[model samples]
Target: MCTQPAQTEEHDVSTQEENLSETDTALKSIIADVLGLEAATVNEFTPETGLFGHLPELDSMAVAGLLTEMEDRLGFIIEDDDVDGEMLETYGGLLEFAHTKRVEA
Candidate 1:
């Protein structure tokens, strides 16, 4: 008797979402590395948690470091308007911004 192979399930996210997810992952890794956060991973910090305030490791210097790292990693320019705390209010927001920038670039 012949046996049938098991079928695999796949997600149906849009291409934009997939690209955003990839960018988010990279951003999360960089954030974790730069801030030395102990949240286990970037997902630990939600959009509600104020990164600069909630994350002790995310002071001014750390923010600057993170920004620089992001610039180099994403291969794009960060404008002054992009420095608003709102842009980084949460992981979701950051990911959204990154995706937007990626498309713009």
Candidate 2:
């Protein structure tokens, strides 16, 4: 009988971490491009980095543009109801949201 090796949990976790890293990179790039911020400044964003209320560059109009860019670049549809202050509150939140939407798509 022929059999294939089963996937290991370690391998799965490593792949997941890699995907998260890629998602993080993409999100940061999108944010930088949309807000016209330096890539280095955006690269400095941490999970706790406040986005909406804190960043003067991230106004309501900018949010709309940002989301549109995200949808185009990330290949996902963000519904009107999916938007909220919390999702745009921090880099981590938006990263998580993007990851979830991409996986779902």
Candidate 3:
């Protein structure tokens, strides 16, 4: 019984990690597509990689399109109130936001 419970717990953690990975991949694709960037360029992004003000391609106008694509592709609605600089500050920040929204959805 102890081993069974442990196995179940491990499985749950593994599943959560898998889901996070999927969200990360999906987000990278969305950013690349929205900004007309090469997939390789987006794939090179690390958690600490700066976005928003850092990325020349992700200007104010591009932000709108990016959020729209994120909503359509991720199947989550992002209200105006949710728009914040911290969410777009780094690659990790965006991934976490998207993963949280995805899990909520």
Identify the candidate with maximal lDDT: 2
Candidate 3 residues 14-63, lDDT tens each?
88799999999999998888778899999999999999999888889899
Model 3 residue 64 lDDT score: 91
Q: Which stretches of candidate 1 lie over 4 Å from their true place?
A: 1-13, 38-40
Number of backbone-clashing residue pairs for each candidate, in the order shown: 1, 0, 0
Error of 1 at 25 (Å): 0.8
Superior by lDDT: candidate 2 or candidate 3 = 2
Model 2, backbone clash pairs (residues 3+ apart or across chains), number: 0
Worst 10 residues of 3 by lDDT: 1-10
Residue 57's lDDT within candidate 1 is 73
RMSD of 2: 4.8
TM of each candidate vs. truth: 0.74, 0.86, 0.86
What's the candidate order when arranged by decreasing TM-score?
Answer: 2, 3, 1
